[model samples]
Target chain A: MPNKNLVGIFDSDEKMLHAAQKAKDLGLSASDAYTPFPIHGIDEILELKPSILPKVCFFGGATGLLTAFTLQYWVHAVYWPMNIGGKSFTAYPAMVPICFELTVLFAGVSTFFAFLFLRGMHPFKTSPFWGLQTENNKFALVFDLESESKAEKVSSLLNQEGALEIREIIE
Target chain B: MTTATASSEILRPPLVEGGKTYGQITDDICAPMEKRPPLGWFVAFTVAGLALLWGVIMVTDLIWTGVGTWGLNKTVSWGFAITDFVFWVGIGHAGTLISAILLLFRQKWRTAINRSAEAMTIFAVMCAGLNPLLHMGRIWRGLYWLFPYYPNTMGPLFVNFRSPLLWDVFAVSTYLTISLLFWYMGLLPDLATAAAHAKGAIRRFIFRTLSLGWSGSARTWRNHEKASLLLAGLATPLVLSVHTVVSMDFACAIVPGWHSTIFPPFFVAGAIFSGFAMVLTLLTLSREFLGFKDYITLKHIDAMAKVTLLTSMIVSMAYLTETLIGWYSANTFERFYFINAATGPYRYCYWTQMLCNVVAPQFFWFKKFRRSPVVAFIISIFINIGMWLERFNIIVIGLHRDFLTSSWTMYHPTYVDWGLLIGLFGLFFTCFLLFSRSLPMIAMSEIKHVLSSEKHGEKQHA
Candidate 1:
């Protein structure tokens, strides 16, 4: 038997969410789901884990703050301690702005890169379901078919949920 | 009608008007990019290109002939360059406010204008960055000196981390980087949509590479949403801090008019005031030229006008507070500076700033004016002028007549100064025109999200 995946396409996000929930109840494991925008409650229905990007941002910010403070301290106090206005060599008060700036810079840049890394996104990578119009109006759910008989069951399920179209693609 | 039905009618109207379908939203936005450049775009682009060319010539002359090309003297060492820098940087703040702060506040209306506003931020910062580099005299040497990289020659002398000038280097660059990231991230899903609709392979290849192969998968969307929220959170404070640091450039100094406890908030308010005006100016033109009137509706203009009004009042209050403080201080220099600002040689600039920044936006108090695009656009232009003159008054008036009678020299801007200013506008408009022609000006995916949620809300209410 050839390996195939059943794809269900819906015009609206609401229908897709409903279909996804019903598929879960029916014990059909959906390999992936796609939408034009982030649909509320779809993650819960799919039983996906919460994203770890926030944690990445926090750590990235912490590292940036440390780096800024260390660089400022070393440059002003230790490296070439020049006193112009009789202020202290450390002058941490004056260092606050750059510290704040670097913290945000590090956090923002790192989190963006981390997001792309986690999602396995990079230039020149093409979508497998590029022809489905999922990036525009359509919503899609793909289920890997283990048995030939399962195709009919999946198509019937999608039909009952009012799918706009359904297709089977051999991998 | 029943009470429930009446209340439902009273609810806020739809954000995306014309009852656009998801596909229609994508098509409307992508249409400009897909079609040939309009005649108006070509004419505007040509004018801007010429202006940029003039500016490039001015910069090259300044570099070759030295800072002597400008009107800088012993008294007013920092003239048009610094003022233009602050003005441009201030202009960028509104973009960040719209894209990041409004996003955090969950203002669905922001989906209409945030993409272009964020683009404005990036381009404004680019223009802002040019002034400082030009002011450096020998920019090639001055550029690397701003950074505190290690293992360098000249005794490995590190830049003064305590200096507000150095802090500006850090703040502005970080601001540019973060704004670029936030803007690019917002563009990904829309770029993918554009790529899908793109006819030619080259166009498709360009957008696909730019979009990083966005699949719009639910898992990716989940993470993308989280990252956007986190970035918005980061950017809010970052935006505030950037202008605060810019203010500190003067606040930390001992100049009579520049030194004030109120500089940060004052500058921030004025920045937002000017920025919103610029947004108004651009959006009014864009909606007319690009035919985005439906998406950028009267409601959006009203909201932006209200923000401009609020910031204008804050700026007005700051102006009053500064004058009051100068009077109460009993310091001869401070008192003289305030009085001189109003009635002295540079009084025209001061009065212009007051009329434009303070008095002009007062018209927004009336509903008819707030809703009137013509009124909003005209007032925005006034505010832009007023804000520029505000910087000029602060920087030049503060410097030209300082402590000594011998140092009291009136500064005049040579033609080069004016040329460079015109050139910067040229650079800005040129970039903006190209951006509008090449990219989707509106955020298609966000608009779709708004449409679906509106539908969801209607269902819940029913």
Candidate 2:
């Protein structure tokens, strides 16, 4: 028999969640669960690690702060210092607004790109379940199976858990 | 006890009416984009296009001739253009407020409105950004000077870090970029839905590219949620800072009416007030034209009207405080500025502002008015006009009668000034119409998420 991935399609997120949990309890690892919208707590069942994007955002903001201060200090004070209203070259108060703006800009932009990178999402990339209604109302749970016996067992478990349809794609 | 429980359930209305399923909701929102646009959209687009054309001509003429083509005088150097800029920027705050702050607060009602409101914010910023560039008179030559890029021959001059105008440059640009990112991030899942529903290859290709191959995988959704929350957190403070920096443009000046400490909060309140008004206007019209009454319902209008009412009261208090502080200061120039604002040659403008902004929104206190789309729409228009006049009173009136009596002069906007102002509205509407026709005006994914939770809540209650 050819290697294949089994997909169990369900009508609602709740049914899909229950099936994923049951599959986990049965020691059958799910490759992925796809839904029209996010199912909260599904990650715990899937055993996915929490994303570290917040840390990325913090570091990005730090870099922006350093860049803003260095650029302002170097250009205004060191590069071409001019006496305006007798203010000091450092003018730390004047530096605060740009620093705040740059911090947010960098932090926000980095977090967005990092999330896309971590998720492996970009233009023209295609999902394995392309044209499936998984993006609509349907919820799909995909699993890899090589043996007919394993496929039958997984199919019975999904059918018992209210899967509307069972399909397999050959690798 | 059962009766009480039943009544409480009845009192809590459904956020998404008609008990829409996920598939039905998708069809309702995306169907319009798939079909030919309605007659009203075509008419509105044509009108807006003409207006944008008029504005383009005015801008071209002003650039070719000079800033002198404007009605600006020696005393009133900042005239209609500055007022338009501030008005549009303030109008933008409502969008970010709805999208970022409401999202942070977990106000689900924002799902119906946030997408369009965020679009409005971006467009309003576009409209606001244009005035300054046009006012520069030589935009192509001077535009690069605004940034602090080094390795330039002209002394490698740096922008004035102390200047609030420079702060404004950073703040507004940052606000626009963040707003656009936040908006597009929200659009991704919905774009995927649109792509899935698309029949034609061109439509599918366009949405597929924009959606960046989004699959509703659990891991990605988790990360998307976290990223959106983080963005909303960043945007909340960024939105406030944008208006605060804009306020500093005037507050930093020593001019009597403009130099008040209350300017920042007052300006922020006014910005929201005007913004919600503009939102009401656009939402009401879109509800009628686009047939989205089921989604953008009376409850949404009522919630927005309450916000408008709250901000209006804050704005009125600021006006009173400004007058009080002016009197309490006992300074000749300060006291005269207040008195002149109320009773001088520009008193008509001041009273008109008070009527439209302060008096009109007061009707929202009555449930009859707050819930009525017509009342809300009319008051929104008034607030828009009133907010524009508020900027005019601050900028022109404050400068016209400064310390030097010889420099005092009356200001009148030339035809080009009027053309540009009218033309901007045309541009705003044209962009909005195109957006409504092409994209899902409502957030389909968010609404579906909310609907599922709502169903779960019902199950628990039962």
DockQ metric, candidate 1:
0.77
C-alpha RMSD between model 1 and the true structure: 2.0
Off by over 4 Å in 1: A1-3, B1-9, B458-462
lDDT of 1 by residue, A14-128 (tens): 8888888888888886777888988888888877899999999999999999999999988788877888679898878877888899999999999999999998899978766
Docking class of 2: medium
Instruction: For model 1, state the Cα shift of residue A31 in Å.
Output: 3.1
Report how far off residue B444 is in candidate 1 (Å). 0.4
Q: For residues B29-65, could you state the per-residue lDDT of candidate 2 as single tens digits? A: 9977989889988889999999999998998899999
- Tell me the RMSD of model 2 versus the true structure: 2.3
What are the chain A TM-scores for all the models, listed individually? 0.92, 0.92
lDDT (10s digit) by residue, model 1, range B1-462: 355545654687777789899999888999999888778989999999999999989888888999998999999999999999999999999999999999888888899999999999999999999898889888888746688776866566888787899999999999999999999999999999999888899998999899999999888998999999999999999989889989999998999999898999999988888889999999999998998988999999999999999999999999999999999999999999999999999999999889998899999999999999999999999999999999999999999999998989988999889988999999999998999989999999998988887766643310
